[model samples]
Target chain A: MSIEGSSPKSLFDKLWERHVVVEETAEAPAVLYIDLHLIHEVTSPQAFSVLEGRGVKVRRPDKTFGTLDHSTPTLPANDRGELPYATPEAKSQVERLIENCAEHGIELLNMGDPRRGIVHVIGPELGLTQPGKTIVCGDSHTSTHGAFGALAFGIGTTEVGHVLATQCVLQRKPKSMRVVFDGLLPEGVGAKDMALAMIAQIGADGGQGYAIEFAGEAVRALSMEARMTLCNMSIEAGARFGMIAPDETTFEWLHGRDYVPKGLAWNEALADWTDLRSEIGAHFDKEVHVDATKIRPMITYGVSPDAAAPVDALAPEPHSEAEKHAADYMKFNAGKPFHDVAVDRVFIGSCTNSRLSDLREAAAVMRGRKVKEGVVALIVPGSEAVKHAAEAEKLHEVFLAAGAEWREPGCSMCIAMNGDSGKPGELVVSTSNRNFIGRQGKGVRTVLASPATAAASAIEGHIADPRPYLFAKESA
Target chain B: MSFDPIKTLTSRTVVLSQENIDTDQIIPARFLTTTVKDGLGASAFYDWRYDEDGRPKNSSVFNGVDPETHKILVAGSNFGCGSSREHAPWALADFGFRAVISSDIADIFKSNAQKNGLLPVEVDEETHKKLLASPGAQVTIDLETCEVTFGDGEKGSFPIEAFARRCLLDGVDPLGHLINQMPAIEDYERQR
Candidate 1:
């Protein structure tokens, strides 16, 4: 894969070079080919309208896939079988995607289809997200696919249209950054904790204008699902692209999935993917190393994701106007430990931590414990596949027994677009990615944490560390 | 949809001096259900600009300024950090903003702004500080020279890709240009 006599290249450099249809220059960007374009109800409508207005058919319908998320509700119907859409427009968005996909001859995982789920969640589940491919979606968490060692990123609707019409996107080469995690992660800390810890070390904008390659001992030790969780939040660190080199774990997780190649082709794909890692002496524009062992179960106390501290730490004193503003909005005692921060709601699902393992983690904490009285806890699986798998394991009974609502799969309560959100002024410990102001709901204070921490917090009615519950189970 | 060509614009600026002002603050996810891309101007920064009762907030800078005259929005560093929603830029353009100047702009947002005809200008920190300190300061953006002229004759050059710049100047639709390269795309796909 190396160019003749050229220096050893990083993983990102290899992926970028492999996808270039036209080289970048002073006058123009490189026209990079898109290997997979994941579309969903919320972002694809306008892109489809633009395509219809331009009077062009999709260039490669085979490479395009659609799913319904965001606008679709997590609540199922009663006797009438109505979908409880948040609005008429929300319902129409889902209907429009079905129509658009039918017209364009693209495959769509429609509602009630077992394969349907959050766009990011379903991509990897279906094996459409493969190593060395360039994946783009209108959703920022498109970086989720990069865990397979692909060059995946989020694109605006305009670029979505460009990819639909031409199968190529105009992209300038971004700088490369390697974020290395030193040492093994502690017992209670998971990938979500690692991600928040990294964002805290680097400011929210630390990885801007660069493609971040997550490397190091802890990252290598993470399971495929955990890797996706880490890469999924790369956008929060302001990196458009985040990836890991594909290895045995990646191939094992992807094997025999719906769209992945068969036996002979699988061997060929494996050989190509094995070469996808960065070679020695590869150059990086920047390198950051964080001590993973020191990264306890983390939680964000401010509107920004980087406003994070360990679960047992005291609420930080405000340093800037922004920090003061965040403190006022979040309403935490300045010097009190987060353990005293009472929780009003708990949301244990999002593209960030709604996979099977994430559900199992939450279920383990809730197996015999009860959600504190008056605290509304909702457990929404990421996808229907995740839902069915969890149901087979009877995870729903554990959540329901603990007084948490077990809901259908979608991007529920994550963006608050699907009629699932915290009430105004309520404090919610959520496993979702962003904790932006009013993101969960107007005037709502969002504390981002891992599934285990969220589940433990729900049980205690406060921000409780997960180590006690996890250790108790190990001893049992 | 071809945007109106933006060659030069002179306008007073509205400043939101908050770092990491993400797209959710620009246009919340709830207002994104529309199949078309129009009328989002009213909902741009809905939570910031309006109260729960749907009335404009008295403290919001948006309510104090006239969109027609204040076409330049000067924001703090790392503006438009989260989400890949083009509605963020569409809402800005629909609200009559022609250019956004920041010390650091998120990569996807800067791309979306250019395609939708809203200019994204990234200047030096000193210039950004000056702009942030002076709200409603008259600013001039000249795409011809890729420079932003502001208070007291101070100026800073911003970078825009040459292709994006040409497309903005011509008011040509980039999708059309990309569509014309269908043969090249097909050839590349076939070789792969």
Candidate 2:
């Protein structure tokens, strides 16, 4: 099992090799031990029903956690009584989740609980997600947990049922792809820009069927929040999962969290984590690198996340017939400059960017500024915890003072699953992932950007650079 | 275990000219909330074929077509591009689409479709165009030969993976394919 090279293998290679259950079995799928499983209101119902039909108890309830998001309404605290949850249809689903969690002995963070938020967000914040763990959730954004150096991925309801029944998942090991980013990012260029630039470099399917391990100096220096942002969009690049090995920054983030190891166990955990780096000269199936300094604040003009370009760069000329056809369908004029394209709305929230730091960045831009007249700007925190933290820090006040509507935490405007959506035909600057046509709502045009860019777009009523604000804030 | 591959196909083909049509749109997220047996066929193409009122739109080709008669879906490039919801293929299979003729399809969607016994025929652009132009032009996809023939005798040989072809011909799924090798597996298990 020894990798025979002097050059150290990347951390991804080491962990993956360590977890090899069966060596490429053609007759049977490999069985992998799952360390943590997170579930949400949307994808857990059918899984629970399956368990019920089988009369089986969750095999590893201790490793499972549940939360309510997606369908949870973002009504003002005062208006909770009048919200959709008050309706029978919504209430039953929410109630069923509570009952299911109780029946399975799984931890339930229902709506209104301070810990309640997007399942992905709460997993890491509470130290439930850790390095070397295999995490799966019934949500696509589950890759967000990979920021902790875990192999986290999304699963379907049936797979969720299977995991609950057996506490093991049938999996085929994926080929590994290493993505390296050199140099430091400029002030305004955040993790979202890094992810978008990577997606753009590698077409949407470049990393298909591979686990991408992000490395290099730029990635190593990123905060846990930034790393989560990088991993959240791995799915967009068509990677099964994205991960970064846990470092000092990672350990510091998990130090005193509720579910994290304590005292002697904490020291032992650190010792193990320290050994988690890749072995010397381990081989990867593929490797790609990006110059972090070359990437600018990016935005998506088309449906897929990969259809993106640097903010200052003009939209690409349609080089292929497929490109021409797709551009025509999206009504995007290729080769045309989108320099001051006005936006009808701006959204700043979702699992991708609803973090506390994300809110702070947006707040810095909104300070002493008002949202452009006639344009709707909304901010939804990713989780109830984030909402509370932001409120305590008065980030919500800053957003509200700037004429932005501050709402509760949920997956608002990210997928339009809940009722939060933009009107058709309206152009929006969003901090969420995916800009697919009607992704926000039917016919709504979305431009995915960083929170700072989204906030600046709201103030200027068009796509604009946030360099001045970010720099000024950094210096002050 | 042998099955008639041609009998698995339907008579009429419906064309959807769009690339990157996701599984979510094929079967909306709402339907995913229920069990696998709660009738996904009736809800197939729920988003694209209907308006907000749940009424079939005249603009959609699916509006007036009888479910049983329309067995093949002639789709544009990059069909089935989103979430790996097997329900997309389930709905399509349940709705009587025996085969999907597309210039391209997302890899996972194609695999899921094949596993569910829905033939995914990858045709060239020229063949796809001719098929679309002539709505009544029936294309016979022979799984045994891996060839497609239109009514005008426009014949083209398409490539399918050997494993997938074997599965389709044998009327087997991935599990079924493995089951066929049970003796060897048991022998290996005994040795272990």
Q: Score the docking of each candidate (DockQ).
A: 0.84, 0.19
Which regions in candidate 1 have their CA more than 4 angstroms from the true location? Answer: A1-5, A474-476
lDDT of 2 by residue, A114-184 (tens): 89888778898999988887888766677888888898887666567767876655566778888989998
Kindly list the interface RMSD, in angstroms, of each predicted candidate in the order they appear. Answer: 0.9, 5.0
List the candidate 2 regions with Cα displacement exceeding 4 Å: A1-10, A20-23, A77-82, A86-88, A317-336, A473-476, B1-17, B28-37, B52-55, B63-65, B74-78, B84-87, B98-192
Ten-residue segment with the worst summed lDDT in candidate 1 chain A? A467-476
Q: After superposition, how far is residue B65 of candidate 2 from its true place, in Å?
A: 4.1
**Among all candidates shown, the one with the greatest TM-score:** 1
Please provide, for model 1 over B38-138, each residue's C-alpha lDDT reduced to its tens digit, 9 standing for 90 to 100: 98998888998899999889989888789989999999899999999999999999998989999999989999999998989899888899899999999
Q: Give the alpha carbon lDDT tens digit for every residue of B1-192 in model 2.
A: 212344334277788876667676687655544434446788788867778787888787787777677778888766776565667787888887888888777656776676667788888888878766766456788887777887667787777766667667775444333334445433443452
